[model samples]
Target: MVPIPLASEPLRIGLLGCGQIAQAHAAALRFLADDGVARVSAVADPDPEGIRRVAGIVGDLERSYSDGRELIDDPTVDAVAVVAPTRFHRDLIAAVASAGKPLFTEKPLAPDFSTVCEIADTVRAAGIPAQVGFQSRFHPIVRQLQDWVVEGELGAPMAYTIRDDQFWPTGAVVPGHSSWRAERSQAGGGALLEHSIHSCDIACWLFGPVARVFASTRHVFGFDVEDVAAITIEHHSGVVGNLVTVFNGVRDREERRIEVFFERAAVEATTDFIIGAPEDSLLLKQDGAPAERFDVDALRRATFAADGFDPNREVFVYQYFGYAAFASALRRGLDPVPGIADAVRAHEVVEAAYQSARTKGAANVADLRSR
Candidate 1:
């Protein structure tokens, strides 16, 4: 399908949900709107309060719907952002694709990766532009590392390690506040599926696709879901990596870090700067050589904080960059980065890890298809 010419008009974006992540999507759309790339034209949610909350940020919507299907049916919406819960993803994505509208959605695409192939087939048949919310791929630090990998500065990642040390979204979740995370039926799994999946996506990007995994998971927080998880992923490139995630930690900070050991050099990066975070740091060291360090500009999040634009971490800023990249891709008639295929690949690995944990044995990523 041909893209609507950028010179013609801005794409009208419709939001499908109004939960916490929806707020971040609305905020990011504001940045795109300012540049005439896209604008939030409609929003839909079952709860009036949710609609009201999103409307506060996206401004007066051209239309509002009690059900997301109605919004997808609205011809006025040029593209849709499916920010609904995981359980709704398979159906919502199929609906949006059936409508032939380009769409963006939060990651994991499907809960247990069961419907991924069906979703993939539907999107391929429709040929609508699609992108996933793996915003970490858009992080400046991640890009810097990727560039080095391409240039062979970090030659063929001999070993990779990613740590997603985060707070919240675990233990004693308030019933309404992302409590879906604790529900295996709703969210699919705990820390490994929800949090570590981001790092898993990074692992796939930097180290190559995961071929197999052996995992151990624990329900340390009594959430009926595993709050702690450790997984060893073997990438097809002969690079083995370890990812550890825990949601039970109470800390004053969050750290999203990656370290890659190459043939002769090592690279380190921090600052997946989600919201109201400060500067980020990156260091590269080679054997018996001086280490080089650099500071990555976190899209003026600190500047916004210093000038009082947003003093709270609730306003996510990195996603602005990710969605902006997606918007540009839409205008150019190109597939967006971290697109649906990427989501499927990441989910397949996550599913394999969970299966391995359950069976107390190794699991192949491709085995998700049979189960």
Candidate 2:
């Protein structure tokens, strides 16, 4: 495997794509700049306005390119973040891997499972460190849930339900603005792939690998993609769960609420879909006991106690914890969490769901994984 150079200087990150998500990463880089961890040194976007807006957030970037490949070729860029549309991931990941740069890509890694596999293979062949943006994995409530699972506090898993909803990303939602997400060719799939891929990842993380899935989908917004999907998943460990993902017309309404039940306890957590803050809450109720609520800040402090950074001072929105963790891993020359393998597994589950939707029966996740 290629080794990341141990450097005292801040890691220079080249950002690809300057859309809404790119802007969030820019803001995160700005936050991490205070600790000398990383900074946005360059940005690439076909849209000048996007580049300009991201530059405004990051401030005084060393370089900007209309083509992402140019940014990948720039020697000064220590690492690269590919925030471009799903359709463009395959080519950009190939380019980044060829250049031997550590890469951070937003999910879904590609529009389809086969392409995601191709990109993963490219990265593996190049032996470069890679991370995929399942930022929810870094959410404080999610961390606590993971801890609960590991500590057996939740007892034997019984069932779960995750509802992920977001304001539809179309011109209708934001007047005069067009979203690539409205196109199936660009976004791969709607609701399920574009949004609740995070939910799929979180489910697998908290439970176990999904064994099979049965799904149904709807195109309520009349887009080429499905704006709603309801999937039932059976895990390898015998836990069963339901996930509902929707891209609705609700203005500025983005939310995810998860409720998981076990033999000994039940846990429920709620947070904003795109940006989770310290004030988000999680509640736990053991058998014959009252529900106890915990704010995200308390969980964050408890989870990251050894990191030496105070959760109160840092901005928790824009997935700051995820980026901070990425920067720290790069600086330490360690592999990042929620890596490409995690992304591939999530995509496999999503693909299986889509297949089950089409076949009108349960689809085996292992059937896709075997390929």
Q: Who wins the lDDT comparison?
A: 2
- Candidate 2 local lDDT, 251-321, one digit each (tens): 87888898989889999998774434533779999988888987666666765554566556556454566
Per candidate, the number of residue pairs that clash is 0, 0
Report how far off residue 35 is in candidate 2 (Å).
1.2
For model 2, what is the alpha-carbon lDDT of residue 13? Answer: 88
What Cα-based lDDT does every candidate model obtain? 0.78, 0.85
Assess every candidate by TM-score: 0.90, 0.95
Clashes of 2: 0
